[model samples]
Target: MERPSSNGDCYLSLHNFKQGGLVYRDYLFTKDSLMVFNSFGDGPISQSTGAREYYFFPRKNVIPQFSWNSSDRRLEVTATDGNVVFFDYETTAMTAASNLLAK
Candidate 1:
């Protein structure tokens, strides 16, 4: 996951591999919160389904204070519920170049 600057938007992509298939979800960060946009998989997933569900029942409020450790390739996000979620990511050349341009 690439860290977003304050007031910047970030895309979060989650992938679950099981039963020889892949389940994926795409979310966007806006106003310090996450909103689900697209998803595909099987079974009853617990995540928010679509725009309506996300608008009505959003995910946890994420604080704007994002921490990114380039060396470790980790990102830390704090939520309003006093919980923290950490993500480890791999950066490609395109992503790294894009991040530089963003800065």
Candidate 2:
């Protein structure tokens, strides 16, 4: 939550909070995957399958939450019953990918 960089840009960091917990995140730019670990011990992490198309897919107990595209900052995911959801970092939020998918 705190931006340690003086440039004031959107960046990521892992630091310890006063409450005695670790917040960590790994941005795998190569795989276009992200692993976020919060204090609650439940993580929505990204795992690499090394597939050329989707590259990687996130799964928790056989449910894929998100997919990654390294070429473009896009995340192709599926919701309940294979409902497709996409997220593009080029803009912001899921709406960005929705726009691209809509087009």
Candidate 3:
């Protein structure tokens, strides 16, 4: 959907699907292009990308480094200011236990 900004500028509104509730990602239109927060990340990661080393760490480790190893075919991830993590391209863990399963 489209909406007008309070400053008289126009912006494009976006919606995101989340587990508990919906998320919104609004895009501001500029003269050249539309600018939006990269909530997801800079871009997609792969063996050639995430699987490799990254020198550009976030200011406060808020943005962790992720990579894929073509040799091992595994994904390597680093937590914010913590130990490194790896996944064998298997199922992802749930954020929290479902209420239906809880007392």
Candidate 4:
């Protein structure tokens, strides 16, 4: 079966399978590109990218540096004021203010 397209001011649910997973498409920081995080049974599964490193600043942890290691596939949240939090990308949940970056 085919799904009907939205004419103009129509809206679709975030969980709409036809339109794809929940989209943060217009999310402020995500304006550059679409960053889709796959939610696992428990929560977020993992983040995948072909880059050397990625960085971010979780809304709650926005105080030193937010960087990730692509080789090891890890996520690091840091503050500009010098606070830091680290986690393995393949094993951590998505942060509230997480921002994706290129190598």
Which segments of candidate 4 are over 4 A away from where they belong?
1-65, 93-103
Give the worst 10-residue stretch by lDDT in candidate 1: 94-103
In what order do the candidates fall by lDDT, top score first?
1, 2, 3, 4
Tens digits of per-residue lDDT for model 4, 12-39: 1122233344432211112012223333
lDDT tens digits, residues 1-103, model 1? Answer: 4455566654343332321343344444343444544444555555524442122123445433356768867665443333444555542111221111111
| Candidate 2 weakest ten by summed lDDT | 24-33
Candidate 3 per-residue lDDT, tens place, 1-103, comes to 3455687654333333331322223323222232333233344433112211222222234434456667865555443433344445333211221111111
Q: Give the TM-score of candidate 4.
A: 0.26
Q: Where's the lowest-lDDT run of ten residues in candidate 4?
A: 24-33
| Candidate number with the higher TM-score (2 or 3) | 3
Name the top TM-score candidate: 1
TM-score of each: 0.34, 0.28, 0.29, 0.26
Root-mean-square deviation of every model: 11.8, 14.6, 17.5, 14.8
- Per-residue error at 22 for model 2, in Å? 22
TM-score of 2: 0.28
